[model samples]
Target: MRPLRIAVCVKPVPDPKESNRLQIDPATKTLVRKGIPLVINPLDRHALEAGIKLKEEAEGKVTVFSMAPPAAEQTLTETLAMGADEAVLLSDLRFAGGDTLATARVLAAGLKKMGEWDLIICGAESFDGGTAQVGPQLAVLLGIPWLTRVCQLKREDDNHLLVTVEDETEQRDLLAQLPLLITVDSAVNQPRRLSLLGILAARKRKVITFTADDLPVDLAGIGLNGSPTQTRDLFTHESTKKVELLTGSPQQVAIQLLDKLGLTEKGAGQ
Candidate 1:
């Protein structure tokens, strides 16, 4: 049996639990990201969990990779604590404000530099962007077959896997070949929690940090300048809900509903 080499893509996002603290920058048109703690994108954790489990089954190596700012090293540290064999952080000032395509390009370059691997895994989408674009884009850049929204996966053999991809309306099972990319959803598995022992173990493992110059990346295909998408606007909608309990007979309730909706001659606030 051959060892399976798996690479998982991860993203650092503002702790969703603290989303109230998140604000948009009026001048830069970016997230006013500061003071807020960071955590791995929820779905990406599932991706990492999938790779870790596969490595355990095949006696393989699982590497974690991310394109983020220097501060995101903390996020990668968390992944190492969760059992990733090796972790790589691709950080460069020029890589900031990159769109999904640009981000994928840098990651693809990193993978190329790392040489051949048997499998690649990523989250179906990120909680912040929710674009679900990076995984498929990486597949296209690497010219490999890919599966998305995979909630179930089983090793059929060293070279093949049985995978199930699901959505609200569709679910399909298929056999996948090696050197394939997959984006997993939360339905795949519950990501294991970080343990004290794992944290202690992670201290011995140093994360690899690379700048844009370190990889064979085209300077023209990176950074905010390389991103084609432009932000039109950033705003949050304010939603207010008013609950009113109407206690009346069937006929009276119908009248009340109509009145509240301003459908009657003597409408609401009458």
Candidate 2:
């Protein structure tokens, strides 16, 4: 049997621990990411773990793909240390400020250029955007079947798979064929840590980079210009707290509270 081919999609998001330091740009209505250290989106780590586990069991290779700035090369390199055979980065100034749909378009084009694959895995959503749109959008663009919120997977055969997915109401098992895409939930698996040997091995390998010109993408369909949704307003919410002490007996204080809340009449009616 031919070895299975797997592709894992990942994103570099700002560390959640540093969320306090994150700022929103008034002009773009986007998070200001300058100087913040980037790490793999928490849920994306589960997706990568799924792909690596599949590759190990099915005797195949795993490649990690990302659409990010040049600085994200370090994030992709970390995937290499996690057991991906290779990594590809799609980075270009023209690809900046892209929304989920625009991102999927570029990813579909890049994946088409890379080669054929039996499976493609992604996180259910990005931590920063939390849109949960890219994976399904990529599936639509690629013209493939896809499943989201996947919690378990088993290889039934070279061409067939058994998948388990969970939603708010129920968990169900599904049978799917190859050339499929799936977005895994964080509950799917625990991500493995990097080892010294894996890190050293990753240093010897290079992350392949592709610019806007390298892929077959319509310029009009990428970046901020291609995004259909625009944020009209962005601001930080100001929260205020007020404390008052009512001086009286318990009964008087209770009545005062109801009056203050404008519920005295309603309480009396009841």
For model 2, the local distance difference test gives: 0.91
The regions of model 1 sitting more than 4 angstroms off are 240-249, 255-270
Please give, for residues 1-270, the per-residue lDDT of candidate 1 as tens digits. Answer: 588989999999989999889999887778876998889999999999999998888799889999998989999999999999889999999998789999999999998888788999999999889999999999999999999999999888979989999988999999999989999989999999999999998998878999998998999888889998978888887878878899889878878898778787664334
- Looking at model 1, the pairs that clash are none
Give each model a TM-score: 0.91, 0.89
lDDT tens digits by residue: candidate 2, 188-227? 8999998999898888777999999999899899998998
What range of 10 consecutive residues in model 1 has the weakest lDDT sum? 261-270
